[model samples]
Target: MGRLQRLSSNACQRLARRAAPQPIIRRRVTYQVAGRDFLVISGYEPDGQRIFYLKKLVRPSLQAGFEFVYPANRRERYDRDVEAISRSLSLVDP
Candidate 1:
């Protein structure tokens, strides 16, 4: 049993070493919203999947976070739509 466990562990380690690591490319930008600044972080994975993260600079605790994942093949459309949404973002006072 001990020999079997050792062999299994070695096999798992070998497989992990053989797998290619995904690279993360990210960009940080600040946008003006309602006269306040907000931080936006956007990035892409090695598979071309896109991710977007936004947070309020002034009051991060009050910010609601969300995540949207897009298929790798739709990178172009995702980029276009994210750009449009960023340009149209605004904060309204209650």
Candidate 2:
């Protein structure tokens, strides 16, 4: 929940587990695009399955795509891009 900090290759692999209770994030996928880094974390609970994704868009040219599912009973409710990145990175709206 804290800012994910700058993660190394090993750190990214380590996050691929259940670390919290709410939202119950259980899986993480990480890769690089252009020059920046991206990460996706998905999980499921009794209510439904949710996916929270994060991307560090270091390169402004790459297309950004991510999704944030919060206790989502339906997948279509959440946006599939910037909002997802913000949610995963804990970015707050001003």
Candidate 3:
């Protein structure tokens, strides 16, 4: 199995362990800093690929919001790159 397959397998095991209580659950954690929202989420694709993402949300409003997602197995590198990109972000009017 490839890395993605292995990750999905592990997630399935963890999900099964939690099935005794509810069977299915999805969880996401988010926070805001410097007017930017950050989130961590876990999920699986239709092909059974385990997907993990660190997202940065910008221009939050009642109308709409823009977001960027970074997915890398190395958590530290992902975090660092996202932070740097977030710091350099600037919005321009259409």
Instruction: Judging by TM-score against the true structure, name the best candidate.
Output: 1
Off by over 4 Å in 1: 1-36, 45-50, 53-67
- Ordered from best to worst lDDT, the candidate numbers read 1, 2, 3
Candidate 3 backbone overlaps, count:
0
Q: Rank the candidates by TM-score, best first.
A: 1, 3, 2
Model 1 global lDDT (CA atoms, 0 to 1): 0.53
TM-score of 1: 0.42
lDDT of each: 0.53, 0.48, 0.47
Q: How many backbone clashes does candidate 1 have?
A: 0
In terms of lDDT, model 3 sits at: 0.47
Q: After aligning candidate 2 to the native by TM-score, how far in Å is the CA of 52 from where it should be?
A: 0.8
* Candidate 3 local lDDT, 1-94, one digit each (tens): 6465445888889988887676445433334333344433433333333334344444554122234444435556666655675466555445
How well is each residue in 1-94 modelled by candidate 1, as lDDT tens digits?
3454445888888888779685665443222234355665555544444444443333434543334456647767876776666566655544
Query: What local lDDT does model 2 show for residue 6?
Result: 86
Cα misplacement distance, residue 86 of candidate 3 (Å) = 0.7
- Model 3, residue 11: displacement in angstroms? 28
Higher-ranked by TM-score: 2 or 3: 3
TM-score (all chains, Cα) for each model:
0.42, 0.28, 0.33
